[model samples]
Target: MFGYRGLTISDDGILEISGVRCDYLVEKYGTPLYVFNEEEILNRIKEIKENHIVKYGGVAAYASKAFLTKYMCRLIKREGLWLDVVSGGELYTAKSVDFPMENIIFHGNNKTYEELEMAVDFGVGRVVIDNFDEIDILEDILLKKKRSIDVQIRITPGIDGHTHDFIKTGQVDSKFGFPMHDESALHAVKRILNSPALKLKGIHAHIGSQLHQNNIYKLEVEVLAKFISSIKNLFDYEIEEINCGGGFGIYYTEGDKRLSISYFTDVIHKAVEECFSRYNLRKPTVFIEPGRWIVGEAGITLYRVGSIKDIRGIRKYVSVDGGMTDNIRTALYSAKYTAVPANKLNNKDEEQVTICGKCCESGDILIKDIKLPKLERGDIIAVLSTGAYNFSMASNYNRIPRPAVVMVNRGQDVLIVKRETYEDIIKNDL
Candidate 1:
């Protein structure tokens, strides 16, 4: 119910998404399916671009790691937002669609030489440098090619985010970027500035993922603004921009307090404005990357209930056809989600059941002890807020094929990603 814009309960008590009943989709496309609300995604993109980026005269890059397909890249391109790719495969996916290379920003903690060469060859808009070795490797490649590429220095601002430890990357002890409190950041700036093949355009920092506090982004702006001011005062050079890497949180359940896009943009904009004035320096353009926020709530996963195990005085386990293979967020990050009995929306009989996957592992539980309508065999279960990391992180673990992805709007369902076949799973094995 978090992203219930186009969702409605029919008079017969059937849950419908974008006017398409859940059972109808399951019958047509089969369960263990991924469905995205096309209208919701388009609206989120428009809101970010018009209400936030355009008003501030900055760039909005869609972090492809949240979700990426050739069609997804095309959609981001159609919206006129930049693409933020973290790996060679993502870059190739974008290139396959002929996504504007100049609107692409390449980022990674350990980028290979081939990836850097590919970025330079494709004339990528900017490369976010995370370490000193990357600087050396990039300079070597660019010098050999006699080409100059724009770059952004990713500095660790030492801000601890209130997210899972595995996703935190902005602290000083992290292995992501140059630490600002130490001399490493300054040395990196000097090294990049001296590289004849690199143009140091700006600085970049990302605290963590699924951040709910607006003050964190404000602090990021203040810290980055101070860094820019120091560079200007020390080297007498102006930083054109600062990419505050995206980690905006989204609501997956009723307990989540979602932050608006304007809350982020307005706070950071004011922080940048005030900080620049305080430091007596010119304001630089801002770049915000939002991946999950834009697409998280726009997607839902539909699965079919299979086996049920009842333990007296214990917990009732309801198994679904799909498990960690299709949605690994729960197993990987301990992420929480909400689900409903799509086929029995009006059923008054409710039970608290531990929804689990068909995986062989005991830790493959998707939702732990959730109240849902009494489930039965063949019941279609719709898991909400799965639009972000679910499909992108899907795997062929246990030889299970991934599910198909469909986009629905105004009652029309279009298949975007075809379900993986058993043959497709072994196609890569030699």
Candidate 2:
């Protein structure tokens, strides 16, 4: 099973997503292509909006760091959801499409002065201030521009999420937010409440990415609620919002436990309510910034098998046209994924092989020791659940041009991102 709602296997043993044949898309878009199911994406968006945001009266912001294109920004805006941008480039991408400025929230620990000025200029809804220097920078900018902006102070609640160390941002030792153990978070709050140019709205925290445990968010809400209650009592200020950064897990491999958006919403709502009731505080408006949950399963990457080298009693190396340049998760976080041969979806002729990228690096592996049908040259391979970070993190490693991206719905395909040309790789060269 593909573990996604949009996938289908044809009787002729080929793969189809949203009724569009994968082979047909490969023929038109070329190999190493990223295909997104628009219907599925919309469905996921509706799922979150109806089940999570509307149900609980919260704001859902799509984390643009996952896989943001101008079209994606438009899609999020069309759905009436907010957009989260961590850099000036992402902010500009959304602005280029005339997305609503008030629906954007700027986030980053070390936001540059230019990015802060841009956020201030655009009149973004909120800025999640991360550190002391950034507070100073934003205060100065707001004073000079004669603008007052709403902001939430990002706090480290000292809760360790069960995810990759690289992504665990809520721990006391993490570099992301002010730690609650010491006076740093408290000090930041005091400074923000005292600032004339910044309106201290609430607090924010992101535990980590790719999480499966339901209690993780419950724990996060507990820590955040306690901190918020104490701060509110200390400063006699109303906490109007609670921005819980999203990192909900998705199905990439069989090991992943499939959880629904409704389940995540239910647990978080209960936790937030219980914590608020315990602390004798009002339930502030909640905001969740989900990047991978809504888009991960809606995307699949198609790569062409180039060469197969079988070593006696050792391994079979099946190299594809793309590797770390397009998907570096395996090399970066040992992220696991499930892939199938698009041309032989139901084939029972299994063979053990390691799917590798064409990159020169030895660690540029895509999948390891997977049992699939005998793969041949030109066989189309579909790597599922790549919609989140694949294209967003792609690079020009080894000078391999990144692949094109297409969105499919109702048997219709539209190119969303053009395939990088050979010249595009060296365009910045002197």
**Best model per lDDT:** 2
Q: For each candidate, C-alpha RMSD in Å?
A: 1.0, 0.9
lDDT of 1 at 19: 84
What would you estimate as the lDDT of candidate 1?
Answer: 0.91
lDDT for each residue of candidate 2 in 1-430, tens digit (9 for 90 to 100): 5566789989999999999999999998898999999998898889898988779999899999999999999899899999999999999999999999899999998999999999999999999999999999999999998889999999988888898998888888988988888889899999998999999987899999998887888888898899888888998886988988999999888888777887777888899889999999999898999999989999999999999999989999999999889999999999999899999887899989999999899999999999999999999999999999999999998888989999999789999899999999889999
Q: What TM-score does each of the candidates earn? A: 0.98, 0.98
lDDT of each: 0.91, 0.91
Off by over 4 Å in 1: none
Candidate 2 stretches with Cα past 4 Å from truth are none
TM-score of 2: 0.98
For model 2, state the Cα shift of residue 268 in Å: 1.3
TM-score of 1: 0.98
